[model samples]
Target: MGEVRVVAVDVGSVRTGSFAWAAVDVPAGGPGLCGYGSDPASAVASAAEALAAGRRAVLALEAPMSVPVPQEWEQLGKGRAGEGNRAWSASAGAGALGTGLVQGAWMLSELGRAVPGLTVTTQAGRWTGGDARLLLVEAFVSGAGKPVATVLGQHAADAEAAARAVADRLGGEAGTDVVCAPHRAFNLLAAQAMWAGLEIGADELETDVLVVRARPVST
Candidate 1:
């Protein structure tokens, strides 16, 4: 039988990153990190090119949100006592505290509008337990230093620290293995793209590029 390939995307307002892999004629192992990219157009283009090179492919994207919106904010609030409290207050002040999930859903809807055939999923939507930030923090810690934990406070520090952490994590065998095989490869690739942008001093608002590989699959 021909190979079955898969593609995953992590989309953002300005930049979008994707990853793809083939699982044909191979063991029941993880998916490969075929490629990544910045914009949806480029990411889709790259994936097509990869499909041209490989056997067959399927696409999986992170869902926008499955859980309640306020719950997600509460999740982000943990360990961020001050900012969390502030965000909570702002939400209360604006009477929009519980709309985070709705916002995420809306964003996902808008993104889907922009990219047809794109699917949306969230960390919770994937049934992947634990906070997304924690995963990011763990990745950063494994790759970089034991600097001050940014969850307490410090946006720039957190960004730098996370970037270094992601770089370090991706620098070794384990890191590569995770990105190549994990189900949530899109999140990892997105984290890497964010780290790269940080390294290049890209503005927070500026879109960044991520290169991904595409593989072919039987329909």
Candidate 2:
């Protein structure tokens, strides 16, 4: 009912740069970036601890709560390229889905160890349909020509991008709308620049906090 710190964690199956963290204060205004972590689960815990500041936190994961069945995997992978024959194509799809869904349970459990009573949901909750991932990708790419840097690693932006998505949904009920971090939001928010074409050349976020309130809450 009150403010909840919203953090989005983009889980990775790999051993390094496996996690990115982004967060925002709910019903108020402010965002914090956690960058990337080789041990992302631990990094997420640390990020939550710092941003929570003794408040409840909501975590949004870019993972499926349940793994797909073989048939389900086939369905998910249906219509992709290189599906030679119908049967082979189905098998290929299944393998791809299985690979992508691997160890998701471990990641979820790791997160549970960190934040108790932390609300969790899949990234699908944030979008309208099939192109959801692209939309988020667009949000990240849209920041081109803005001043942004990754203090953690290359994957950090994805985590923040995920965080913004989570905040937009959870904060929606609180009449809080989400928007992209301005070029300045990333300025000094990270270490020296590793990513190009996004830095706007500022050291800090000014009044234009990259998030702007666009409309009144409909009653």
Candidate 3:
């Protein structure tokens, strides 16, 4: 049996999203979209299940980013506004949002720490939303070290090309042999919200949003 190669992803808020891949004997292909969800924990857990079903496998994840927030706001009820109360409220809201973002990042870090044998990485930019198939392809190609001709135009076509390139790099059956779990529904909505300019706050958001990889021990 050979090692299975797999790629796991954690979609970013403003950025494209995070992704990771590995090779295991279970399957030797570029990678497939195992599971998509808001939190990294669930995503990783699902990916791990996929890997176990196969054989030896490699794992990857997205790295977390840190954004700053005001300490006074984080404390609790601290500040009040006068004439510009609306502006103050907006500022406070932003700060609260920033704090949540920071917390999510921290949670992501913690998830990674708790899980062993997981490889983690981050994507730098925003990926325009569309069909999941296209995004999967784009992620594969991007991970395989192929040049993405143009991210702006022909987004779907470019992503497909990248997917093919990644398949070539993996040296396995391009699309057929590779098995992928469906993207989790919550993740789909979250990804859409992110694309729509929604800020993923910490306190209100779930922890699963940050998870990127997981591998379950064989029974």
Candidate 4:
């Protein structure tokens, strides 16, 4: 299989206008962070242009890309499965999700408008197919007890952390749906994009908001 570039964004408050991001050119390799910056729109536009020029990539957002609802619950008021105590509706997760809904949707819409026939998906097969496509995934940097250290500064470190996590995951199972959600699900971001005049081509059992975390370390 060919290499898929990974671009991870550590989203900040929309009001504060603070953001950070990291790009890993060869995720399967050392998965080294090749790029870092605070300009999200420029990074997104660049990725879109790269896709238009025939390059496969993954846009990992360090935010709640999808909201999970309990099967019998009347409303989405809890965290997703496997998220433990770090509820998506609480604290940082809640804020990020709110921002992600807008930022992710805007990015998707811009990509759709910039690329004539771009295919965005959560599936690895289609994303890494012969043609160029963008795969979207949620990145979980820290939660519960294991808080991510701000060694390289909070937002920047978060972006790098997300890139590293996703890269390592991809290294182990390149073809597996590591971060692609199972079952056909509805994503608010995708819906928002559709409302913004972007037609997103996604599979029935797929949504562009599967979560990716660092593989658990052996005790």
Candidate 5:
């Protein structure tokens, strides 16, 4: 594929929640909302229509990469080998791990089968923060100069934030790593996934949010 469509998805395992967004028509100014929904499958469908299969694209998922069952997360505790995040214990918890293995793994598998050539990566590696909420707020205000969750909701904001992270990483900083105090992973995922596609949003073309300077965030 010549171009790349940046798609970020926040999937909920079970009733938690799931949402998606595609930074389509990036570069003019800001990108529009292509895949915006609660259902992972449906959200991808929406994004698929808005995305061009001809171009190379990647899907960033803030979910667990793999989990055998719901209770497995609790047993995992803090982490085992490469399964947990030292920066924050959230990645070791049962809830986070559960969703990752159950919902996250399922989504990754499903998306791979459904979308041809779509690269999906889990955000649960050593690249996330202890407080997802705090990181999200920083990403929103720093990028847009305001609290975006009110308008986009937590789910959409999460998806948007991930998309922005991906965009910033693939732009020019792909060669470097985004690390903060305490040796956290931060925006490492974006940089690590540089081989995949990530682009800037446009203004001339219509999108959900106007282009606001969004960059890699880690703290």
Candidate 6:
């Protein structure tokens, strides 16, 4: 098992200063490289750069990677089972999710285009290091955000926060048991990537979605 790098992108509009990303190379320690960008290309490039030989890269997107459709179709207005206080379709979340849909897909497509051998997996447990692989995750930075001092601004701080959350998970932290459930929306982001020609490892109904939650801060 070699080093694992985690890159988290705080998804926003396509306009300048809207999109921001942070990357942390585990074992090397703290936040490695982070910046704000106008597009997802820069973030994609960062992930590609992190995918070195004998290393694994985890790409965390602060967006709704999967929409859990309730058993009662009319109950679509509710959130996922474990999403207690923070619902994906809430005011702010809804906006971010809608905007991130295309950007996330584009980022995945670009990653596939950039790295031919990029083995993308939604399961974090399968992220055993040693070989070059890419793990995709949905970053949950909601619920008053992570307990971290703001840096640069909210966007950059959020990016770093998400990165730290993912890093902690890879370091053996307990994970959220949120299920993406079997639906047309399962693996939503990856499905778009597949439609764009990326070779997906099989569209399973009940697959794992790495929902990396930020560390709790004690009051």
Measured by TM-score, the strongest candidate is 6
* Global lDDT of each candidate: 0.27, 0.36, 0.30, 0.65, 0.38, 0.71
RMSD of each: 16.0, 16.4, 17.6, 3.8, 12.4, 3.0
Decreasing lDDT order of the candidates: 6, 4, 5, 2, 3, 1
TM-score of each: 0.26, 0.42, 0.27, 0.78, 0.49, 0.84
lDDT of 4 at 192: 54
Superposed on all Cα atoms, model 3 deviates from the true structure by an RMSD in Å of 17.6
- Alpha-carbon deviation at 157 in model 3, angstroms: 11
Error of 4 at 181 (Å): 9.4
For model 2, residues 52-77, the per-residue Cα lDDT tens digits are 46455554444321221234343542
| Candidate 5 lDDT by residue in tens digits, 61-89 | 55432222123345432332332232123
Worst 10 residues of 3 by lDDT: 124-133
Tens digit per residue, CA lDDT, model 1, 1-219: 133333333322341112111111111442333444333454445434434554332333322111112234434322211122223234332222233223223333433344344322122112122112111111111122324433323322332333332322222221111111111122322333233231111221121112111112124
Error of 2 at 22 (Å): 2.9
Runs in model 6 lying further than 4 Å from the true structure: 28-38, 52-54, 129-132, 147-151, 180-185, 205-208
* Model 5 TM-score relative to the real fold: 0.49
Which of the numbered candidates is closest to the native, going by highest lDDT? 6
Model 6 sits at a Cα RMSD from the real structure of 3.0
Write model 4 residue lDDT over 1-219, tens digit each, in one string: 456678888888645646888888763346666677777677676576557656677888877766654455555465566676776778888888888777777777777777776656654555556433677777887753233546566778777778777777666664322222332345654555455455455442235455677544445
Model 4 CA deviation exceeding 4 Å by range: 14-17, 129-132, 144-152, 174-185, 196-199, 202-208, 215-219
